[model samples]
Target chain A: MYSNKYVTIYTLVMTVIVSVLLALLFSGLKPIHDANEAVFKKRDILKAIEEYLPKPLDEMSDEEVLAMFEEQIEQQVLDAEGNVIEGIKADEIDLAKEEKKPVDERKYPVFIYNSDKGKLYLVAVRGNGLWDKIWGTIAFEEDFNTIAGVSFGHVGETPGLGAEITDNPAFPAQFKGKKIFEGDKYVSVSVVKGGVKDPEHQVDAITGATITSNGVTDMLKEGLEIYLPYFESQKKS
Target chain B: MSEVATKKEGLFGKKERKMLIDPLNDNNPITVQVLGICSALAVTTLVSKALVMTIAVIFVLAFANLIVSLLRKGIPKQIRMIVQLVVIATLVTVVELTLKAVDYPIWKELSVYIGLIITNCIVMGRLEAFAMANKPWQSFLDGVGNGLGYGIILILVATAREIFGKGSFMGFQIIGPSADYLIDTTTNPWFSWYMPNNVMVLPAAALFVIGIIIWIQRSRNPKLIDIS
Candidate 1:
């Protein structure tokens, strides 16, 4: 038998009560968290290819984002061999999980944008960076080789450094119009630490963020390399 | 925290002096002590966002500290930290939910960081060291003081970074609207200062600023030079 004060019944009761309250709190906010994620994903997709969308991003609504994305775009699901994976919905493929699958088994979703110039292809890229993870949507020209626009996001990197992958506008902006394949060997866009004198391939990397710059370069090379066959076949066909 | 606030009611009214200086100089969470620097560096790129986040963090820290101090007697010593965590987490949840309801835009910008406040050492450290043994009123003051202290440094850092970084205070383009005015070296958006020392945008900058603060604080009070 125990003296209740020694047991600290009040403390125990409050603890249980607080824990339940916390459980309820987390449960209640689950929807909001999901909504925030949805918004974030929307923002990412929009930012990935926002060059085509009209400006004043604040005025743009979610419904409009979805509508613009739907009206101006068509999705193609492809297997690693560059063959169309029919009956598999591109929208249904979970991109976050898809990267984990063997490159061949993965559902590679391409957004075919019907722009004024022609069709543009957006490829999703995911890879490990020096700090944590880095991923992006690289929109390609109809040639399926030149980058039209690109946007990247990262996790747990130093701010102003690795986070420059997203926070610094220049990093993402650098990918625009950069050719991924010069002749044959994959020359994915490179991040140059100092202002790039070599205009053909490198974008000036964030100053003092060289390691992060290299991390991004590696991720781009690694993540984008797997999709080369897919793009190459498209180009040839 | 309240009890500790009243601890040495002797010289120069420590409460009065501490309240004014805790956030301003001596015990600053951002500049000097360098504890809660994550939100400061990352979010300061946008002035409005930085301001909103500053206010939210202030609110959360102050209230959470107050509640924890009030309920300190009821918390089991063995599970004291666990109790503090629960309390901080619950308040964070509440702050997050309230943001979602009230200011949706600020909510969108700051919600992720708000949840992260639970990890901010300033809140827990103050609660355990000052509030747990102190009285409620004084603990509340300590929390408010510390949060404000953190906020002041955040605002100063953010204001400096955002204005210079974007050449736009908040969203209003302080610089000329034309593309000619923007600093994009490569192409259109002119992204130079926006790209400078990405360190400025990360939490490390907070550490950098905090180092300066410690230097300033020490310089001011030769007495505080000793190991307390």
Candidate 2:
């Protein structure tokens, strides 16, 4: 039987020891963890234009991914009015954090891939999925309406269903070459269930995942609409 | 000293061997004891994920058991459960941080499940039922045996799910459409009629697989059958 004093002392010592150990480990490995996360984000962004990359995203080492970002990719931060916000690297902008801010106050991150052909504009967007937040990086051709490629990511969507947006290659493949503009109006792209009637503006949705499909549609409509101003400015320049 | 020498069992003696091997079958964690099923269902959708998860659990459980057994004397009975929790939580965090630094993709895939290991009943159950009353080496073996027991079922369930559900084994397409499969179903002429069952991909299917495993295990080892 432990006396009250003994029990208190035991608990105090145990708590202190566990906290110190965890705190030391966490601080010691913080740099590596941060580096890994940075590379992961870069990989996801690059996955949008995987077809244009010199090598497959999976085959590239972390150092290679970082080097490619440093060499071939130019990043920019933009405000709601389409003006570039200087001194902030595009990769530094956390879209998840930005999503929490007021719509007008949010900053968008754009990655421009300098390929031999031309500059491909990649933009990030975040929205709600069936279970949690869903995000995607969409790349547009120089014309700014044709989708060159897209790569989606989700936090907690169901496996084999909603998560197919990221897991299945075929899902993102549907967006390739799809036009987001009808004449001059911004229609974005729709993930239509059943059959895609408008091949120009619609893609077939994932089977049995209506909410997530709709989430992607809504996310693209609202997400791409914000960047239209920036695209217009870039086209003018 | 002579009495102590006489009492000393060899390192891999009968009792120690029992501690290591019992949970593999008769007292298996998942199939018999029915612990740690939450994570079993969640991460077994992919064999790679399940394999990584099993390694993480084995590491955590073995260390947690050894530490708890070593501290069993000093851990106040009034706060034993809390002490056990603290130890398990610390081990889980360690695994999480290390995994994040070493294999970011697997860490991302197993994001929440790694953290949920702190609540895994098998870890706590062993600490309370076995570690608290056993020697350090014996408790360590017990922990490993139980983790292996849990892992066996996890990998088995994942194999069934991944193969039947996705027509893949550890991400290699084994049988499916001609475009993805290793053995082109379109031209294979043998598996052309087989389509991957989507139900097996669902989390509910893990329960059915586990149920079948439990049934098979109990049927073979009648001693494991519940009389109650």
Candidate 3:
């Protein structure tokens, strides 16, 4: 039998060994992990313009996505007032963390996917879902008013219900061609229950997912408001 | 103690082979012992998710068993459980990191389940029950056996759920577009009748499927049933 003192010594030695091993393994894998995360975020951004994609999101390889993103997408970090912030990469900013800060202090990322057809402005937004956080990228066309497309993601939501905001293609598809502006007034799109009566400013909410639908509505209204100043400046220029 | 501990068996001997084979059927980790049922329920919603999780568990369990078997003697009696836990946790983390690095899509769908493997009882149960008393080779086989046992049930449950619940296999729609075999949606847009069983998509469905599997498995093998 192992003595108490021996047990303590063995435990300390094993703990030290395990800690060192884990630390080394984590450090060794950090680069690949970071690269994968980068590509995943890029893929999500590209998902916003899935219609214009050369191939479907599932068909395109990570390298292809990274390559397409590198070639066509230009990223800019902007302050609340719409001024471009230098020395910061758009992808590096964590929108969920940024959402917690005051509006003036947050640095917003704008991803512009440019091609011969036109330029699409993708803005990142994050807000509370029924259970946890939900975030997405909403892309705007050259007109800077109508939505080109949108792709939403969630941390955790009720599967088959609230989670359909991401899982169901129809939910996001409705946002296409929907306007963020009602002729010069900033009227962000609403996810209306029962049905969307207005063609421009309203989208159909998921029938069983009122809270998550409302979350999207609130996220769109507030999340897009931060980008208003930037959109206004773009329209003028 | 050393003499009894070092009674090494042949690499592929009968005992060692049984260690690998027994968990698959009569002594299954899921169906017989009913360990690791939580993950089975969580990941079996999709076949692809279940398969990926099974593979991850296989890697973590096999290596953790081998390493623990190798270090069985040196592990202090008072801290043996802690030692086993540390080893399993280390392997699980490595598997998680590798999955994140190489197969990012599977990792995305699997999400927290890979991390949750560390909590799965089968991994710890093998390390304690078999690896502690066996040679490294046999311990490795035991890990493989239990992993496969857990995996088989998961795949069966996932297949049932995916087919009935989602009407799909690994996210591909297996059921024909419409119950009417000749209907073309592009031309008419009004001729489609394939409704997925919403109940099958839920976690409760996994429990039902697992219950059926256990029932069938036990019915065939009366020895697996405990009268006591």
Better of 2 and 3 by TM-score: 2
Compare the candidates by DockQ and give the number of the best one: 2
Instruction: List, residue by residue over B139-188, the lDDT tens digit for candidate 3.
Output: 88889989998999999999999887766788776553433333333344
- Candidate 1 accuracy as TM-score: 0.75
TM-score of each: 0.75, 0.97, 0.91
lDDT, candidate 3, at A94: 91
Top candidate by TM-score: 2
- What's model 1's lDDT at B176? 35
Docking class of 2: high
By DockQ, the candidates rank as 2, 3, 1
Candidate 3 displacement at residue B14 in angstroms: 3.2
lDDT of 2 at B8: 65
Query: Which residue pairs does candidate 2 place in steric collision?
Result: none
Estimate, for each residue in B99-120, the C-alpha lDDT of model 2 and write its tens digit.
Answer: 9999998999897999999999
Model 1, A4-85: lDDT tens digits are 5854775677678877887787787778666655655656766877777666455787677767766877887877766777
Give the alpha-carbon lDDT of every model.
0.71, 0.91, 0.85
A216, model 2: CA deviation in Å?
0.5
